[model samples]
Target: MPDETVTAAEPGVGTPNVERDIEDEEEKEAEQARDVEKGGVPVATGAEEVSGGKEERDPNMISWDGPDDPLNPQNWSFGQKWAAMGIVSVFTFMSPLSSSMVAPALPQISRDLGITGDPTLSSMTLSIFVLGFAVGPLVLGPLSEIYGRVRVLQLANLFFLIFNIAGGFAQSKGQMMAFRFLSGFGGGGPIALGGGVLGDMFLPEQRGLAQALYSLGPLSGPAIGPMISGFIVQSIDWRWIFWITSIVDGVIQVLGLILLRETYAPKLLGDKVRRLKRETGNDKLYSVYDKHDRSMRAILSRGMVRPFIFLGTEPLCQIIGTYMALMYGVLYLLLTTFAELWVTEYGESSGIAGLNYLAIGAGYTAGSQIGAWLIDATYRRMKVKNNDIGLPEFRIPIILVSAPISVLGLILYGWTAQYKVFWFVPDLGVFIYGMGTLSAWLAIQTYLVDTYTLYAASAIAATALYRSLLGFAFPLFANQMYAAMGQGWANTMLAFITLIIGVPAPLVFLKYGHKLRERSSMARKSRIIR
Candidate 1:
């Protein structure tokens, strides 16, 4: 796949430069054709015509016509790229919004469904959705590779819309849990595939802002959802939460169909091959992704298993996955606990307490906006320092800055709330924590995308597997941990864990990322295809 940042000459009709560029590109294609022939692969010089009236293509081989093909998603215009980014980001936001939006409605749901005996079941109604986040990516990420990002994403979202609407009408606890899980499974599509979409649309150097905007969806959605859900649950009914989200998702679904285009290179090229085969009467036409003996089952199996392989074998994936999981776990923990702290500790109403979540949302907005500029500036400066060569490590400095800031915010929040200090103090702490987490998260995401490149969906899914699990489990245990250990000590422990994970990760990756990539099978595969 061509890097999205690499611009080719835009030729106008009858221009000498256009003609010369076309001639040069044709000569280059001829050279590549000759190379293919030397390698014992049958070649077709052009899709429409070839020497001696017809040409035979190697069924096992396919590739782009040199590097400047306009069909490549990377070659799309900036407006087009950003439009796709915005659409995917919206898709990503809707899922996490649904995940946490039901929090305020859980109590009502429990009463309505007669789920009073075990609180865990009520919590499960909320957290099981997150479990879907963990599971859906394992399959959906790979499916996106086999199919295309837009199709899988849109289909999964439609699946989500149906189940989520069903959840609003679920009569029993069993039905609600089933509906929520299925809805979450569908929602996971955007979370799993959004990174790969961005990877397809932007170059490494141009990815920071795009990633920052994309990252805001998942990071801020949980916070934003509850704020809206709280008012809805109080003013209307608990069921409206699901209905509202379903309605919004329906809107996003329509927009996606209208705006989203196929971005996957292999998938696009495979379709081209099929079209060419039909038009030119060539059965041998095939894409690089195709194999003479490959079956759909083999492709699905490989795609499904690759994330696990990455998680199990890649040291970078392991470390980064752990770090991202911890960050996500803490975020959810805070989300679950913040309202309780405000209501129980400070004696605020539920609606008023919910307003405090705005602190985190505001911080996310600020961090993403600021971090976008910081990441872009840092990457560009480091690239210049390294003779215009960018490294994945360029994304790590923000992590370093964020580690201490996050720790400080955690401590301030813990101790201030424990002492029943000014409300603004704890809110400020929450704000700072939000900023730190968002900054770190954006850096980690960009780093993973840059490192994994073509396999970004799988890599992100691998990490998301751990992260979403922790996101689910942490909240389940948060109240107990705070009760058992007290707010200050409990948060202190979390802060210590955050520091321990955050500090060493960037340093290790900065020093050894290249060596690690060199030893990685996935990385090698990406290089060969590129």
Candidate 2:
């Protein structure tokens, strides 16, 4: 949101193709505007740099100083893209892993700390980490837009690692809880920015597999963490859970330092302009955002709160943000409740109880991979059918189906778990539920990216804030819900609420989404959907 002007280079010195470069940038901007007028996708221009010279341009063209700059994430090679995605995923995976892996070890932790309370206490340890997730994105996500993704991601991971490792040293239950919250706050970075980074590197059509891989980090980490933690807790002290992960995180930090590069375009181009000006001694360098006259403090405040602002102003943001928040809450609530169900109801050991998470993990993996392929194919088909108008609404069809499956699966799991139905039956419900979650999450994430391309960071930040808050709050009340109405009825209520939000969202967006987009100043300037 801040104005970033590239100080102009030395006056009167022109490059060999200065005039040609100006004409080329003009041609590109005109072509882009025409593409917008016709609802076709504009060609992505990597970070542009201005040559050190006085250049005249068409008044109508959006002039970018230089073309073919490698500093841009968009200009990076396929290998570079994967490298960034992988590093980001590692940071993403570590935080959630720290959160949930400790679930299996919570009982031991309680025993060692000489504390005994409700099943919710154990759940608190896991869900509190997600609370940090809710809060961190508001600051981190927006800061990335201003500062770039890589720097914020790595720094936040280190911040998370410190508190997470310190959690092991906590002398009391309250201390541990505080440590978990702080760690989660730091760890929230990857979850918020991973998709935005992918959006930066991949076009909408080519993003499926990249999204699939990225999704694996969060979805699988929770499941995989418990598996490893189960064995580790059985073999040694529960403290090792934090200590071992901290060491692993150290390795990831090193890898990040080596591979992760800045991905935000404005920040990258701004740096390039600064470098060119330093070399050429010109003072007239500028970026498009420089036309605005906002102060840095004002810009930071505006940028930090933009996600919430959009959430309030945009219908799509409200619908998508609310649904995603509910889904996220449901996820943490289920994780918290399941440990008690298996251990108390079914008489499983902590190690065996932890294994049930495999159902959630498997469902998420299959759904993400399947949904990824389905998303792009679905888009292509809709494009052909619409005479290739390719509206963002084209991404909505999957939400209709995924939302119901998620609701139904929750109902099934709740009822079955309550009546002491076969363990495998509950697992089946979980599997189906996981599948629905994958589809639902993928649909919303892709939709956000589709609707808010330039501001994807802020849009997702809004979703993250609400969702993580729900994740934090839901577990606090999980015990009461199951106790008051029993699993079947409680889940039924949840399913009903989900339906109220989920079912109408896709349909409303499909029918009225463009009209909604028409009202959005941010969406109008972005390249999300043609």
Candidate 3:
């Protein structure tokens, strides 16, 4: 089958002045903003386009004016690009914070709500939020593809804020459950949409640091959320947790409106095309992205099912999603169990026990920064060695280094805890594990974006589905598993599984990734796979 996806920014060789440099797209953004204010969009009327003769151009297709068009997000100024990233990171951070902040408050909530004996209901209040994570991405990720990212983000943030605040006033567990799920559904917008934004803003070679920075919110938020809340639940009412998150989310919603613009090219170009037709009285002008009959029914049908289709049909997505699921599952497993370890095994107070999560936070920070330092550098070097061409495979080599460390940490933490070793030792092992998992996770995230440049939202949604499901399911079985096997043996079993998944995943990409991409209809088109 021929490639169906068309991006206006893709370098056009046969056409004159079609090549684009997203790194420094000139000042056409100012023109685009001005045109928007005047109720239209600017055309690619560069000096080259005008001088090359308009008669030779294809007036039907709308694209950036050469590589330097400032209107392209890739060509935006460094400040603007980072500003977008920073705001999105904050959005991503708040959701995960809300997910775990209640962990420390669960006991208090159980008492207040008269569910102190029902362990299952108490856990549901915490884990049910993650279920929404799985569901929201399936719908919202695709909607962001159809609508603009900024519009969807602003709306989702507002949705999360309203429902989250409602959770603070709930009198029954059922109401709290419903409110939490809806809040998580709204919060899912950032996690689902953030990857696509990075894909839009950065090239394959430039994605490592961006991926690393964006990941900190997901990885570190869980670690930090309980640290603060342990103290809150100890001193104040459980309702404050929900109220505080809502306040922060309201602020983030405003920031998103102010800082985040439409990053998805299809949405931006589609809007521009509609404006063009209205202003010029020519209904024929359309963008390459405006292919097919894109009615609301068709868009919704395609967008809603795209994640399931990718997971079912794409082998590459299946493998990546499974690995991510296991990684995320283990992370949640630890998050659910870690406090108990400190409070019960080590005999620490609730507030003090929560502080141990800082170890994981430090490790996560180390992992993200390490990935920033290593991933793109490794990709660039490997690409140069491969005759100045790049492949998504170049992003996987760091996984080789990260996988072993993860397994080692699992063993260390499990056995040391089993033997009642020094408190610091188990914390050290947790740190190492955090560093390893986040590093590997960062590489895989960037690889997916690089591989499926156009369909990144759908691709990520596939992984997010698995990640969220595993995150929700793992905590339910964690205590039982540890009780049966003991920490040492249980961790050893987990390590073995990690080793099985982690060791070969990267090597497969290194050797056969190009071949895999050859079979993927939705992946980025490359002249040379290697």
Candidate 4:
């Protein structure tokens, strides 16, 4: 957590509202004390800035220079802010692509590696990657709180890149499983931490578009990967899929090195403290965030347990996490079983089956765009109506609409495929469910982030844990479920489950979310995680 801020050393990089000069050190000390009393922890909202005359402040404690400080990610120029987001999005895209890029190639891979007998082994080929996703977030989410976003992201991405390359060379089922799991562990960092980065850079009012785009990466990546890899598996060797994804990921990793800056306020403030002490030769200068016993062990211990605590005790976490997990499991269930629907029912080749995935890709992409536009606009309108105070519940409206649509999509695809109707009908059903799922994802993520702004990483981790595990386990049961019930009844059951869980959950949030926040032990009073 070094000084990764572009303008940390030079606090005067942005225009400050104040023009008054300090006549003495005493005057500056008084001003600093007043600023602290005002509760400045970076992301300098007007209320946190100096008001007229400074009443009191702390001389040794450091924070943003003013509401206009460019070092605050919230105050950064549009280009700088979006560039960081876009780079993270690309990283986000690469990981999930790795998760499902091997879906169509499963048959080829099974043949080459002599994986015979069990269809479950074929399911493991992709689900194992998601299992790594569940494990990594338990560690990575908390580390990002201690180390900062940029460093954790860069290192973990490199971990993904190297292991993904290894996946291409895996000669046996055991090697492939190990490689895929390890690669997923590395790739899972972005999904766990990307929400925290959004909470860092954007205010509640600005979070809708950021959350939508960020959520889109992981959602769209899995849908789009199988589409591209189908042809690669059809025309070339299946091994090329891993190598090709790795090449693209490698390029994104390099751009991250060059463009991404640190977004975590605690890390930036801590780095600033070190630089200040060196310049002033005053050992007492410290960041307020660094006041805790933040030695490596303490941070590690806290970081490791924080997400679990959030998951265990917080009602918001349980309610949101459970519903999100159901949808995610459904999404993966569709991904794992989708190609077969086309190949067996519609008499399509592997490459054409992959093209059917485009229905999903188109649906998710459209949903993301619609949700992105609707969320922020809805929040802004609600905030204004509430006299300019925003609530996390503002994100609920999108889910109310999206969740039912997802259920419909599932029912449509399931029955249509069961009836062996036109190929386009099943594809249409996939497209609908895909769109509903991504829209719901965008809204759910934004709600968690908005509710626990300071502890956003942990809040997201709580939900993501459920999402990943279900994503893994659902496929293990999919073959059994579909076999006993056929496609129509199987998907109808899924849709009913979603209707039961997904619809009521957000209504609960819209009505009682604020009370839950007030009663929850994990809720933070401050704007940053302490």
Give the per-residue lDDT digits (tens) of candidate 3, residues 1-530: 22233233445555324123210121232223222222123344432246555423446656555556677898899999999999998888899888888887777888877777766677778888888889988778767756788888888878888999999999987888899899999989999999988977887788899999899998898888888888877777779888987887887777777888888776877877788899998988876455343556655665666677679878889989988998888887787778778888889887898998898899999999997789989999998998898888888999999999988988999999999899899989989999999999999999888887656787888899989999888887777889899989988998899899899988888898988987775563322122
Alpha-carbon error at 470 in model 3, in Å?
A: 0.7
Highest TM-score model number: 4
Model 4: per-residue lDDT, tens digit, 388-446? 87778888898899999989988999999999998899889989998888888888888
Rank list by lDDT:
1, 4, 3, 2
- lDDT (10s digit) by residue, model 2, range 386-458: 8876667777888898889988888889889989898988888888888887777887788788777767777
lDDT of 1 by residue, 364-477 (tens): 888898888898899999989987778888998988898788888888889999999999998888889889889898999998888877567778999999999998888887
* Candidate 1 error regions (>4 Å): 1-62, 291-294, 528-530
The count of residue-pair clashes in candidate 3 stands at: 3
Model 2 misplacement above 4 A: 1-69, 118-122, 293-296, 527-530
TM-scores for every candidate against the unseen true structure: 0.87, 0.85, 0.88, 0.89
- C-alpha lDDT of residue 383 in model 4: 83
Ranking by TM-score: 4, 3, 1, 2
Which wins on TM-score, candidate 1 or candidate 3? 3
